[model samples]
Target: MTRETLTWLNTMTLIGHTDRRGTAWHYKASEQGGEPNHYPGAIPLKDVRARLFNWEGVHRRVAVELPASTFTEATHYGLDNKPMRWEVIGNRSALDRSDRDTGAVFGVVGPDYKIHQYSDWLLENVAGLLHDGLSVSSAGLLKGGAVAWVEVSVPENLMTDEGVEFRPNLLATTTMDGSSATVYKRTITDVVCDNTRAVALKESGAEFKVRHSKNSELRLEQARDALQIVDTAADEFRRQVAELCAIAVTEDDWQLFLDRTVPWGTKTGKPDNDYMRLLKEERRENLTYIYRNDPRCAPWHGTAHGVVQAVNTYDHHVRLPQKKEDQEPDRVSSWRTDRNLQRTVDGLFDELDRETYLDLEAVLEQAA
Candidate 1:
């Protein structure tokens, strides 16, 4: 249908995740008015086909018409000296497609725009991962059927000696709304906090992106080869985690980090009034509490990795939208969280030198 026909919250969205990560964000399916969409294990390919993407996006030509008011007696007309009630205009409208009742108009595109069927996308990108012990851990749609994603993960989780347990995942996403190009990327999820992180140290080369051009389908083999490189991402991530764990942070250093990362006073550098000071103190206290006691962050408390985990946990779980209406839908929130985590990861490494505390301070300063 059209966007006006759908509710703002939870319209034409389905999120299913394997129970390994607990329920898919508890409130994701609340508007669906039934049980939360949680599966016992990896979701089967057949189930995904049957339940989520049964329709295709077919392109339809668009046409335009003009009213006859602009015509004059000088123009060729019928014997009445009046033009037709409506005249056919040039085809100025762009072609686009959607499932008549179940999806929204995906995008307005030119003649060269290709319609990549979801079925073909899945078969070419995701289905084969199932055979290699990588299963579909999460899959869903958002904004009607304009965007879709499937997350695949290895069944066996990995842990560093310092006790950071994580699962590396391949996130394959496509959007008909032109928000992004078709992308297959590598990401890691911290099991303790369920926060997503980018697997690559640098941002540029981690994912493969294909534009929606006529030659999109022909690039499938190259995409698969890129994914083979993605498959080895966890090893490098493990090495980095171990390195972070090896860097020790003293109590004094932790306090300095908190001061720099969560500065006192206001953004203008003015001294805080009583109420503002209380709020600021509460923020610091909450972060310190998470650093000292939260299971997600405390296990590696004396190390650099612990500081990173503390900040990530606080951001993911402790932070809240200022207004209830400001809350994002689960899919939108998930996408934003992944991007935030990646920034945190990249920011930390960009400032890390592994030799001095000043480098660590610089990292937190930049992060703040």
Candidate 2:
């Protein structure tokens, strides 16, 4: 259901094959879009460990070689045990662009977007099929991996005379391909970074055209209550499960943990009072706050624990349907429930601490 955003054209489904001893297991991932879903999530298994698939025939993992450019989010689940999608902006260890038309550190793709030049005032809209598609955080390669969120940006200095580059490799650059093969191409053009774009991308717009850069909002807090859980678990010992158990004593545990953990975690580019007010008033939460720096998680965060700024609630989030004797709209608000909200929470624990007893997909990856 989620596809084609600012940079996301389609998704490539993936599955994980791992070794028990922490050895890396390479399961082939396909850049193939669409689904002939092979693993029947509906098919009941003799083993209780197996989680049934809700999107059974929707996504399947196949192994195939992709150009170095395609990227995917390291993690794909939301606070709930449901699947979510994200953009894997280029490789972490390789350069991400090529030198083409312009000469800027982040080579010119097309021309600089003239936000101020309202000369035409004509907004280009992708009509019909694209109208309903996802415009942010649409994962392109659709591969899956468990990577911690990192805080860094594409450096201007890193952009050589070539193109906008990064370490590892770039993503979604398969502009051309061989015969008999259908190639996928997604481009980021007229690239310029500015506050106006951010303002326009947030909630409340003309609703005529979809913004293509879906991942633009992944900054933080977009997950709503789900993000609060991540804030609590940021410092939970990896080799222990009790940390989460203490919080899962029923969902109320989250409210308790969040109150304790939420206030202290810092927002990126935020003053203490402002960040606190932002946390108390708004929905978009991003950038984990760091403090005096701890020993274990400190190396990752600060002396304290904080993640990225909360995601901007400017877009959509979820609202759990309330019982009202059929008096209400039957559905919750579109302000809630994104793909990220559906992914398994158990997996998150696994990512935090290997000693975690909860299996990420096991707890939440079920039929809604």
Per model, state how many residue pairs clash: 0, 71
TM-score of each: 0.72, 0.19
Query: What tens-digit string does per-residue lDDT give for candidate 1 at 250-305?
Result: 87777777777667877898988998788678778987899889988898888877
Q: Give the TM-score of candidate 1.
A: 0.72
How close is each model in CA RMSD to the real structure? 6.9, 24.8
- Candidate 1's C-alpha lDDT? 0.61
Model 2 per-residue lDDT at 257: 30
lDDT string for model 2 (57-125, tens) is 111112222233323532444566455454433311111113222321211111211111001111111
Model 1 CA lDDT for position 225: 65
Error of 2 at 180 (Å): 34
- Total backbone clashes of candidate 1, pairs 3 or more residues apart or in separate chains: 0
